[model samples]
Target: MVTPRLRHPVRRIGDRDIDFSRRLAVMAIVNRTPDSFYDRGATFALEAAVASGRAAFEAGADVVDVGGVKFAPGPPVPVAEEIDRVVPVVRALAPFGPVSVDTFQPEVARAAIDAGAAVINDTTGVHDPRIADVVADSDATLVVAHSLAAPRTQLPLPHYDDVVAEVRDFLEHRVAVAREHGVPAERIIVDPGHDLNKNTRHSLELTRRLGEFADIGLPMLVALSNKDFIGEALGRDRDQRLHGSLAAAVFCATQGARMVRVHNVRETVDALRMVEAILGWREPAYLLHNMRSEGNE
Candidate 1:
């Protein structure tokens, strides 16, 4: 269901263009929040955060997604504090590849863009118009994620009659708003926002019906890395969800998701590459690994 405008071999994020026709991009998560759900503040320090970015890039991540605050209703971090947390890391990682700052604040987005971030990963679906304006005024790409509540807030009860249909509708509207505000289609990405205000069932349904997102006609970014749904589905804990995460990621890629934001960089890169090779999107790194020829022996 992807339209002609959205079916492209390459997409221009900021100063870089990535080929998505035959491969899926890996967006590594570099969280600077002490209360982040996964790492639990392991990379909160500035030096550690920078080092994590470097490590992820070295591990084959196509993009680095830097976040200052955890998305789990924590103490309010001043805008200045948030800027201090992510800007330096973004600056350090920008030279390596495209860096996406995960924030919904317009001021923060502007600061991150100034700090050399190439994308704004707004998990709030650009609830604030100023954020859209900021993206429109800049050369950065915008990731429009569909979430029902504000970032870091616990929802009362999440319910959706048809999760995929509703999510698509939300993304369609947000994409339209971004376009109307002057952000080109080439600069826009869509995410269904797995586990962001949704319960386990909602997340699973979204994952199973991910192909439906192609109707939005934009590059899709899926963040299904060790999320709660994966945990619940397989009765695995956070650290134990890597396999589930990889499975969901592979499914998304097979379903036309262009980018997958994840925590395990090496494993994710390997899995996506395998999928690409299977689909004939990419040739094996080398075809002579275990081949036998009459002259060989």
Candidate 2:
């Protein structure tokens, strides 16, 4: 039998002393782009995007990741265009809760930070030195995601002597780069970049080996919601992958993932609560009260 993994704590956005443990945090995805892979044309207007963010929070999301461009196997937009698309959305959501800007451009990162974004979720893994400077200058948490190929390029057929080991090495180098840029270790989060350049087999292997990343001493955020791998595994289309996506979320929690970025907030949250219960973590007091016996003998 596989042994239960020991959990590690990770600091929240503004609270240095407080760490999120036991319960897995859910990050709702708010795609402002017209051509996002899954939620294409869902959030074209700034007001609509803000409303979506609010709704996601109501649905139990701990954070909202707002992105302007779709990195779905296509050429990247110009930096100026990307910044223009994302800045207003970031500014709108900043006051509501913690906002994370999903981009690999340094200028976009700088603009999003200036516009009140609290976190930088760069898919490039900080390969650009300027990105490091932007995060160092701004007091924002950084999510270093592992991606093998540029977003513009077609994902090269999955090539890896060993996918897990290569990912660990890439993540370690990224952590070192973040430290060299003067960013605190606590401010760093790592993502395995599911589907960024992976096939079904590689993605499953990464998920199975998720615990290995915990040794890096930072919180691991798994982004496996509605990904192609899930569809491939369940033999379903994008819209029908909800059940598979929830299964992946629960598995990630069991494997020690601290954060999950997903589209279906309510479903994922409900599934994770069940996983928490199975792990013997206490539920919220309100839930307990609801479970009380109405008529005791």
Backbone clash total, candidate 1: 0
lDDT of 1 by residue, 18-132 (tens): 8776668999999999889999999999999999999999999889999998777766789999999999999898998889999988899999999999999999998886888
Q: State the C-alpha lDDT per candidate.
A: 0.88, 0.82
> What are the RMSDs of all candidates, in order?
1.8, 2.7
Identify the leading candidate in terms of TM-score: 1
- Model 1 has an lDDT value of 0.88
User: Which window of 10 residues has the lowest lDDT sum in candidate 1?
Assistant: 1-10
The alpha-carbon lDDT assigned to residue 24 of candidate 2 equals 74
Clashes of each: 0, 0
lDDT accuracy of residue 187 in candidate 1: 86
The C-alpha TM-scores of every prediction are: 0.95, 0.91
